[model samples]
Target: MAETKTHRVTVAQRALLLSWAGVTDLGRRRETNQDAFLAEFPLFVVADGMGGHAGGEIASRSTVERLQAVVSAGDVNGPAIEKALEQAVGDIADHPETTDEGTGTTLTGVFFAITGDHAQWVALNIGDSRVYLLRDDRLVQVTTDHSVVQELITAGKLSPEEAEGHPYSNVITRAVGASELTAPDYVTIDVRAGDRFVICSDGLTKELTDYGIQHFLREHRDPGHSVDAMLAAALENGGRDNVTLIIVQVEDEDDSSSPIEDTTE
Candidate 1:
């Protein structure tokens, strides 16, 4: 039910422009993959599905597909983006194929654009899947998790360390298609030369430490290699959940050195 105007995205006047997505099946326990992802011009997403049976896959796939279609049709800005996300949620809630407790999905998406001398980016999400900005050697998480533990941390009811091992650590308060509609938090960032962006699912974050992520990004330098290192670290730790990752780099046209380009899924 999501609607939007059709618009074509033109190439940016930058030294590099590319997108990428990676996914792993449900780790050690589950027999099937429940996570879904997408990457294309101007858009990237990672969805973690939740529900019993195959409903998890349905929720994640539905959210990603609807979001991609709407963005492909040019839906944007806070209001349009919000509506499109709600519609995606509605689609999952209304899905006839869903056989389990109404399915839910964690969605995080990034939209990129270049206009004149400025490069713009938007990060939006409805659950714990995250978007991060890496500059110089510091890594900053741009999206907040909607989990109960995160809320407790925000409300000062629990310390960061205690919340990590809390009983409700995995309980998210909001997710796509879990309710009639869902609202996602949105943040716009000014992209600069030498900025690297990453969007990923909880699978990557659950196993790898933030320092581990920063170290890989700083040391590997290559987007593909960085993703590889992150995944390798996660698999080594246990690979307990479905993993998805997308890496993007921003550089000015004059940067003498070039970075490897990684295409999307």
Candidate 2:
């Protein structure tokens, strides 16, 4: 099931009406879902765990729980994120199963931040998971994947079309846990009206093309519907891996009301 919520935040006298939906599925082949997400106010994150057995699940769940605490503390910044990640690293290491299996997880998503003068979207990525933005009815990938295929593509060695069936497509260059932890690459985007952001794990990408993603987003106005539509398409397309995704829609307005939160299962 997808969990959906709405929030109205006021920052720098600016109002942003945000609605979002998130879901994680085991897919057709996976026995256990090693994906987790937190879709709370001021913060949204998706983590894709890697390793065998319960190691992956533990790594991902611990990471998101630590990050959720950071947001629950009432402030968010680079240092705070770093500290939270450090704590998450310790949590992952504490699990003997994870250490034995060399488990790890990919972290990615966006946070609602009030910078010095205005509101902005702070996107962060650590591995193959991705964050994309849809603005002006045009979709753009915001975070680059830290993977073997991505590195090859950037090096001009592997063409985008040829990289599709590459056996190394699943090999990520960075991760949170496993043997070590890596800092996330961060990006800031100025908030705008009618901006829609998609934070998803590579499982979704493995099944759907970019055009297919954009098409569904263009057809569905409600965040929950958008998430559901995409998830269904991914499963129908093979669902080769565990799938997890979040859709966040933002609208700008002056009539800022108190923060409102609601959930639908």
Candidate 3:
């Protein structure tokens, strides 16, 4: 078993702590893992690629690499991310592996930003990969899927249950490198302690339900353990596709106080 990698960052002004862990598995059926992720502070992302013959792998890896470079340069805002994603698209489109097959990848994750005295969590999504939030003991999907089945469900033509089993469930309407320009949906939320965020590829959700994920998160308080449990559950269910997940846990430093006692004992 390999050791899980963890990254921890702190918001200096507010003493808010953010810790994250990421895992990517080839799964039980895939010949190659086309999923890529970034778990660095202020920037975490998950990219699930499409197209076969290693095209997907190249697309996804290129997307994450571009984003990582942008983040390392200190541009961690919505517009900066969008620009990076656009460049990533061009990079993948120009690659030899994807030039003919037309490869693309889903990009989704959260970016931490601080403005004045307020700290915010920025959620970005494109395609079927998802971002979820577990707060107040409730787990809810933060990003909406941009897929054929998702559109049908929105139009009331299909129920969530039916859409899950639909043959075209994996047909995403939006993805990086799929077109000339790709605009991602972005939402900013106020950061709070005890807020747990999960960014993952569709492979994880396909195997585990929201309730199942929430149960695992609630059972494991540590981000590393939570990620391990969730990934294990997904593989156990049926590792149909490449599975990848990132778990971010926010904490308040002030909440760790302990009572003082007499000096001599």
Candidate No. with top TM-score: 2
- In candidate 2, stretches whose alpha carbon ends up further than 4 angstroms from where it belongs are 11-14, 254-265
- Per-candidate TM-scores read 0.84, 0.92, 0.91
Model 3 segments beyond 4 Å from truth?
1-14, 256-265
Q: Which one wins by TM-score: 1 or 3?
A: 3
Report, for every candidate in turn, its global Cα lDDT versus the true structure: 0.73, 0.86, 0.84
Across 1-265, the per-residue lDDT of candidate 1 in tens digits comes to: 1111122222243345343434454666557788988776577778899888778898888877776776778754566666766777666767776756557888887887444445578788888889988876679999999999998899999998897788998888888765647778888777555777788888888888788888888887667677777878887889988777877766545652333222211
Q: Is candidate 1 or candidate 2 better by TM-score?
A: 2
Model 3 weakest 10-residue run by lDDT: 256-265
Residue by residue across 191-239, what tens digits does model 2's lDDT show? 7768889999989999988898899999998899999999999999999
User: How accurate locally is residue 260 in candidate 3, as Cα lDDT from 0 to 100?
Assistant: 16
Clash pairs for candidate 2: none
Query: Ranking under lDDT, best-scoring first?
Result: 2, 3, 1
**Evaluation by TM-score, superior candidate among 2 and 3:** 2
lDDT of 3 by residue, 42-154 (tens): 78899999886878888899889988988889868878888888888778777877864458889999998766555678899989999999978888899999999999999
Poorest lDDT segment (10 consecutive residues) of candidate 1: 1-10
Clashes of each: 0, 0, 0
